[model samples]
Target: MSHYKSNLRDLEFNLFEVFGADRAFGQAPFDGIDAETARDVLAEVNRLAREDLAASYTEADRNPPRFDPVTNTADLPEAFKKSYAAFMASEFWRLDLPESLGGTLAPRALWWAIAEQILGSNAPVWMYSSGPSFAHVVQVEGTEEQKRWARLF
Candidate 1:
């Protein structure tokens, strides 16, 4: 019942072989995460996406979400919410985000590579996963004082 499929082989190829990400790891920012850890993270994320995300996909499509004009909100099905929570529990959204925001900083290309795989499995979940990432970017680009505000946010 799972339509979600990921190409982990190609992802690893792009990360280690094609991009030479191994050279960037074991250094500042990425000091703790090397190529192996990155691959493991990717594999785990792929599994969560394929199993949990994929399972909820069809149920959500069948039930769908309802927009409440009165409340100016869209009510999501419990099944869809369950899928979102599963992805969140995976904590893979933290990749590429700053450690301050609970993310392990990795190469941008590597980050996007794994992220794209999850997105392909379920785009709506990935779309909502951008909040902390946006905040992290603000923290990095913001002034010193603004950094505190970003963290608070």
Candidate 2:
């Protein structure tokens, strides 16, 4: 069994009921995703978090990443790498990115809702897989040349 436990019900309540994220979907920049799609995304991510991602939590904690002074790099545990790869394969990280970057223009509320699950499941996985979001920042704030470079990330 996995060590991480998520309250998906409470998350949905906050996102749909209190925050009204459903109202934001299917509108304006978020037209690509509707309420039903958003819910599906949440459900899928929840399963991934509880099953695949959470599978590595205890193993990773027991065998943390190793830093090599000579190589100037840190080598993550194999289990952690597997979990991170699973998340990247899901491609949900693209939700908040711009259309030009092959991402859906999702609402911040929905993004945070998704983030909560990933972070809660395995924070290291979320941290290591932040390249897409960083690329998004560079795409938005960087110069034209920099924007081109950000696409490679």
Candidate 3:
């Protein structure tokens, strides 16, 4: 059984009530996404975190990754790989990215809220999936040449 538990109500309260994420949505940059859509996104991510992502949390902890000194690499457990693949396939990570990178313009609050669900379920999933966020940073702050390289991520 998974040990992870998500407090989606609390998250929604903070985002919609306290932070006024609804006001931010359907506005500049977040034009396409509205309050309803944000709520749906949160619900979906919460479900995913509780089910797919949390499925392998304990197994991964028990098995861990096997490091190869000679090859300088590690082999992740199959269970963890499946969970990682599920998260990648969800494409929710694209919410915070720019439209140029095939992502919608989401508020930072929304992105962090999404992050909390994933992180609370399985930390390694969030940690391993930092490539897109890192790429976004590079695309924004890097020179033209470096920006091109960031797209590969």
Candidate 4:
């Protein structure tokens, strides 16, 4: 056995079997998209995570990041910055948000499936990217202008 094993089989089993969360997308916003399309989005996001975001995580851990006391800025390694850009570019940041706010409202299970891959790769990175969903929740509970600001964030 190798240390680099991915739990893709488990992901598949969870998505298609076990919890049976695949049926939630049959109405309203999700009705326009099928399960296969959802799977494609997940696959593409995971590919980007492995090839781009996770590329520098080990090196980042080795070097860590240095902070400038004056500027109050953490000067992350170039590798980590590149990885962060790649992760952001995946648009994984916008999952589970309302379309009005430039997001695709996906099935919760599919959302969790993608989350597992991101979290497995780097938990902090996953949390950072999940801000949009949090913002969406806030928007729902906020006033109109506040909702606008949430979307902007």
lDDT per model vs. reference: 0.79, 0.90, 0.93, 0.72
Q: Which ten residues in a row have the lowest lDDT in candidate 2?
A: 96-105
Q: Which candidate would rank higher by TM-score, 3 or 4?
A: 3
Residue ranges of candidate 4 with Cα displaced over 4 Å: 1-4, 143-145
lDDT of 1 at 120: 81
Model 3: per-residue Cα lDDT over 62-141, one tens digit each: 98998999999999989899999999999999997888878898999999999999999999999998899899999999
- Least accurate 10 contiguous residues by lDDT in model 1: 94-103
What ranking emerges by lDDT with the best candidate at the front? Answer: 3, 2, 1, 4
TM-scores, in order shown?
Answer: 0.85, 0.94, 0.95, 0.83
Clashing pairs for model 1 are: none
The runs of at least 3 residues in candidate 1 whose Cα sits more than 4 Å from the true structure, single-residue gaps closed, are 140-149
Give the per-residue Cα lDDT of candidate 3 at 15: 93
The count of backbone overlaps in candidate 4 is 0
Please report the candidate that would top lDDT against the real structure. Answer: 3
CA displacement after TM-score superposition, residue 75 of candidate 3 (Å): 0.2
What number of clashing residue pairs does each candidate have, in the order they appear? Answer: 0, 0, 0, 0
Deviation in angstroms for 114 in model 3?
A: 0.6
